[model samples]
Target: MWESKVNIYNVFELRSRTLCYFGVGAINKIKDIASALKKEGRKKIIVVTDEVVYKVTGAWDVIEPALKENGIEWVMYTGVQPNPTVEQIDEATKMGKEIGAEAVIGIGGGSPIDTAKGVAILLEYTDKNATELYEQTFIPERAKPVIAINTTHGTGTEVDRFAVASILTKEYKPALAYDCIYPVYAIDDPALMVSLPHNQTKFTSIDAVNHVTEAATTLAASPYSILLARETIRLISRYLPEALAHPDNLVARYYLLYASTIAGISFDNGLLHYTHALEHPLSAVKPELPHGLGLAMLLPAVVKHIYPAVPEVLADIYEPIVPGLKGIPGEAEKIASGIEKWLFNLGITEKLSDFGFTKNDIPKLVELATTTPSLDLLLSLAPVKATKEVIREIYEDSLNPMS
Candidate 1:
């Protein structure tokens, strides 16, 4: 099977150079690191986060005192939101520059962390501000030191150098641009995830599952990517339900969080497939639906949409991660059906109607989805090439889902 394949440039390559520090039950390392940073005469650290997280999680209380104790002046810009925008980046960058912050700390989920990355990019590179960063201009190499303290176990934004933000002016969808925006420090403490709401936990786990599944099937996927993706899928399949059922089980949460990080690394090294490509526009247009819910609602159909293009590859991958479908046909149609059935068993529904998306919205959504920047990248990886009409058909199919 590997004999006839020939490759031209190493276009589907994944590379990152960052020091990784991993351990079990190390949530409080953020404080210890902060104290060390302060002792080293690092002052004027800016913490970019959201108001709810800063107050509710008491992240500000722990990190703030640590910085203050070392005589480091600190400031905060907590206005970042879900699917962060360029305006927020501009505002935060200006604030960071004004305060002369030598370092930046992100203390929440993907949103605030991603927002901090965007701000850091603007601060280091573009003088035209955040709006210009979206225009595809020259990017700088150096950014202020960024410390990512991940409170959410899902988005592995801490390790990756890419920061995605939704720019409404650019068609009201998420725009992904990469730069040297990696965090100087990454702190992953599952303890922070202890207080997470049950729904949020389940939903975010679904998002991580989407990451692994999509990467396992996309164009940039490799043997390493496939292996990592499969392991992540298996771990999630085994651990997500357990974590959901026993929310306080440290062992389950630890594995789930570990799975989430691995999934993030996999997708960051690989690339997201159709589901992530489709969900961005829906979130851009809807904004009411949580990102995880949007993914859960759309992932099954997206899987079906791409399955016909690469059935055998997908079936072989799924055989190990998902049980009960091992003996089925490996053709595209049966593979798609098997994946659909598995998703249904996993309690993920296919209907957009359940989430309030109507038939009337299909055309616009199709147009939006087909035009999304991620579409070409995702489609190139798919087993099948999806045209506008095919995209429309998928959207229509998503309207009435399996009841």
Candidate 2:
């Protein structure tokens, strides 16, 4: 008999304490989390989201009636921003309290859901000063259980228990806080995604691709995470284009929705490195770039430069995912080339200038990106120690999309 000795290291860890309730096409499935909350006999429910998703995705309409049908009275907070700030969290938290809401349901993409997490965290953990919850060292005792309804598939915020909320640094530098991983329920629905515009569909799928790639390649990947990440990358590659080409393809949407969730779990365990660590600072500097598009623009360059750092691991991880390149010695580069080609075919271009980044801006961008506190977190696990200069190279490549 063969004996297996498995080793796990500094890969991302999801706390065993995080609770998750998952359902597909759960637009109507709000009843499950609602019932759970009601069983706890909660008084009121607060549905947090941004205004655009509220009007465009029809999530608000579907969710409102579903809650009413379940006899769960609720209030809606639709002011969550694209990148939510501390003030939005406070306002939402105040509304949750004013309505005597006993539970919170995040009902949109990452922005609303992330905002909901921040608000819910403070409601339970803070005594008088809710903002203090951002600084809490330990995971805050999860406040009211949060049920997330994902209308657009990106960020995997609904499935993952983590949240990203912005704060101001002492120098007034833009900073972010990672609160407790507290998503109690995730409702993923493909029907919710069918109406997404072409550009958003492109950017979000790229985001999912980034999740799978970053997670699968990161150090300390476990057997479970490896399986999940590989499958996610394969599925996203197959289905994302189909979804973009035929926006109404429920089958494509269904596959990508499932892919997003799987990728979410993969990264929630592997933790993001590389592109994401650097992307946050870019987002702070260029608010309109959209984090997903920024990642799409920078990913190919980052992968190309980082390949020499972890050639063996990248080769192993990509060989199975790229059938045509099987048995090739340089499978990592081949798979990455395949990814860049696939991205190009999908209408995604790599020029940062197209997205408002400039050649002259490279040095300042590198300085800012390297300064992210999370940079060390990612660098510690990076196959090659990413340096300030290497980061500038990635930026240079990204500045010229035509390259």
Among these predictions, the greatest lDDT belongs to 1
For each candidate in turn, the TM-score is 0.87, 0.86
**Candidate 2's residue-wise lDDT over 209-248, tens digit each?**
7876677666645566666766777777788878888998
Alpha-carbon lDDT, every model: 0.69, 0.69
Candidate 1 TM-score versus the reference: 0.87
Q: Which runs of model 2 end up more than 4 angstroms from their true locations?
A: 1-24, 127-139, 168-180, 316-323, 326-336
Which structure among the candidates has the greatest TM-score? 1
The alpha-carbon deviation from the true structure for residue 270 of candidate 2, after best TM-score superposition, in angstroms, is: 0.9
Query: Candidate 2 versus the native: TM-score?
Result: 0.86
Off by over 4 Å in 1: 1-16, 20-24, 35-42, 137-140, 169-171, 177-179, 324-350, 373-375
Task: Give the per-residue lDDT of model 1 (tens digit) for 1-403.
Answer: 2112323343666655444445454645666777767767677877899888766655565667667667778778989887787788888888888888778888888889888887777667646676666544555577777788776667778777767667677545544536477787887766667677777787788788788778766767666566666677777778877777887777777877787788777777777756776777777776666777778776656666666554444555566444444323344445445555655665665467877788888777877776755455665666457676766666666666533
